[model samples]
Target: MSNTVFCRKYQKELEALPFPPLPGKQGQEIQATVSKPAWEAWQALQTRLINEKHLNMLDPESRAYLMEQMQRFLDNQETDQAEGYVPPTQA
Candidate 1:
């Protein structure tokens, strides 16, 4: 398989992840569509969201919230951002 894919978030061809970021159909879908940079960005955002929101992974509601956010993010839709978190601008 080619090492690149058209990133659904970016709407352009970009480097793909070496493997699925998660398990099951969701992971496979991300692997087929999301790019390395996009996924990495998501990881950072995910971290911020978790930390800022004090999310408990063991809580089903928290996990579900994160899943919903992840779907919105991957779909290039507006996601719930961390309060006071300003993304670093490209210089």
Candidate 2:
């Protein structure tokens, strides 16, 4: 049996992550409220942000920016988009 959560992003009950995606209280909160699908979406977006923006993970500022974006994304708040982003067209 899988754990279920009332996903804030999807606004419905969905499959939960096996563990928190991050460390600390925020990670625990996300583990409790976010769904696996939503977390995966965030991961995709984070990858785009890193690639498109040429973010350096070694830089604390870059990491902070990503963290802020992640929180906003999970909260369904407005988040920064990758520069020169073009949406892939459906085939």
Candidate 3:
């Protein structure tokens, strides 16, 4: 299997905040409890996965896989935001 390197460290300060899930149009609220460092890492990883062309140049299968991964990352962020998880600001 290939290796993955995500440049992010864990931060506890963000975790201690009271992040109550916001109410949505569907009637109920969604809760998310992600640490600041993990959130930053996830965002960076998503950007790398979406912008990096190296994986696409490797092979058709690799390209397809990367695209799928990118889509999932986007969906996850949307869902998380809808559920009320404020993403960490980019540094």
Find the candidate with the highest lDDT and give its number.
2
In model 2, which runs have C-alpha deviations exceeding 4 angstroms?
none
TM-score each candidate.
0.89, 0.91, 0.30
lDDT tens digits, residue span 37-70, model 3: 4445555664555454345546878656644553
Every candidate's lDDT: 0.94, 0.95, 0.41
Rank candidates, TM-score, best first.
2, 1, 3
Q: What tens digits encode model 1's per-residue C-alpha lDDT throughout 1-91?
A: 6599999989999999999999999899999999999999999989999999999999999999999999999898999999988878999
What's the TM for model 1?
0.89
Worst 10 residues of 1 by lDDT: 1-10
- Which model is ahead, 1 or 3, in terms of TM-score? 1
Q: Report the C-alpha lDDT of model 2 over 1-91, residue by residue, as the tens digit.
A: 8989999999999999999988999899999999999999999999999999999999999999999999999899999988888899999
Could you give me the TM-score of model 2 versus the true structure? Answer: 0.91
Model 2 backbone overlap count: 0
